[model samples]
Target: MPIAITGPNGLLGREVAKVFKKEYDVIELPHDILDITDLNQVREVLSNHMPTVLVNCAAYTAVDKAEEEPKKANLVNGLGVRNLALACRDLSIDLVHISTDYVFNGNTDTPWRIFDVRDPINAYGYSKYLGERYLETVNPKYFLVRTSWLFGIGGPNFVSTILRTATKQTELRVVNDQFGCPTYALDLACFLFKLVKTGAYGVYHVTNQGITNWYDFAKEILRQAGINIPVVAVSSDEYVRPAKRPKNSALDPFPLKETVGSLPPFWQDALSRFLSETQTKECLD
Candidate 1:
């Protein structure tokens, strides 16, 4: 069986394609090659490939920028998803759709479950939530995987930002209020690959097994890199943005664990490994 991965050049998509290619006939498609907003394009690509599974990593993930460009975000995240879902249904293929933690309004302290009632607060969140519902109606056998705080080597992410800032600045002020699981993209890619090989189909909250605020996460990143910059904690109100973010987007890992028969490493461990790899890469470069 073959697997087609959209956004093959993205952070998670890159890792997903790299990991899954070892066992599956992988078809890599980036946005320019197959724009998700065009239904015919999506259908043509899927039909040509005739893949058994479609792992959709394509999304409009600009949190704050989405506020100004809601339609652009919706075009990619909402309508784009609907096109893929319909195409997947027509082809009798399983759809592995990547989602975000923004679907939930960050009011509760507890982790969000796979079956939680979604109440998105911002433009990006609403767009993703709309996409989720669209996929459900169009495809029954869909793996809706929700993850958060993703970072990897191939893209610009929070971890890279913090590390870069810490290396130059004396004091780094980070938002302490918002909290969620810091998932490494490669680990998420592995979990997504695992899901496709199994018969289980539905929603899965796949993330690293722990949660921490951004401030602490930044502090830890600097600590591991042996950078001695001081991390200052600031509230959400202090650092306002156009899009409202969930204070807590931590996902429950129990369901994915039971489904996959294993769980990913903790956020701390993943962070350590990522830093070590980055350091090794920099030394070589």
Candidate 2:
């Protein structure tokens, strides 16, 4: 059976394509080739391929920019998902939709469960929530995975940004209030591969097993890279952006142990592997 992936060029999408290609016949559908926002186009493309599984990595991920261009965000993340869900439902294609932790209100101290009430505070979160609703309602055979603090090689991410800034600066000020798990895109991709194989059709919360604030995460990044730098911790208010981020967006991997047999490797281990891969890529270039 062929597996089609949307947004295959994105951070997690790239890794998902790589992982799935190793075992399955993968159909890579970049936005230019398959604009999911266009319903007729989505139907036409999926109908032509008729893949067994459709991995929707396509999303409006510009967190801060979403504040200004909410319509565009909803178009891609909200109604765009409805298009895919409708087509998948009609075609009986299993939909593997990637979601986010932003759907929950950040005020809670504990980790968010898979069935937690969704109360998104920002435009981006609301848009993703809309997609979740559409997918849940339209497609029954779907894997709705919600993750957070993604850093990967396929695109510009926090890890790359921090490393780049470290070269020129002596000290870095990162938000210490916002806490969540740091997920390596490759790790997440591998998890999705394992998950889709089990025929488990429900919502799942997945991330590298652990929780830490941005300041601590940045310090670890510098430490793992063997870079000596001072990471100054600051409150969220001090580093405010166009978007209001949740203070705590940590997702609880409750059902993952039962579904996948074990929790993912610790966040530190994933970080080490990511740094090694980053260094190797840099050297090869």
lDDT tens readout by residue for model 2, 134-219: 99999899999999999989787889999999999989999899999989999999999989999999999889999999999999
What would the TM-scores of all predictions be? 0.98, 0.99
Clashing pairs in 1: none
Q: Which is the leading candidate under TM-score?
A: 2
Query: What would the per-residue lDDT of candidate 1 be over residues 93-194, giving only the tens digit for each residue?
Result: 889999999999988889988888899999999999989999999889899999999998888899999988876888999999998999999999999988
Clashes counted in candidate 1 amount to: 0
Candidates in order have lDDT scores of: 0.91, 0.93
Give the TM-score (vs. native) of candidate 1.
Answer: 0.98
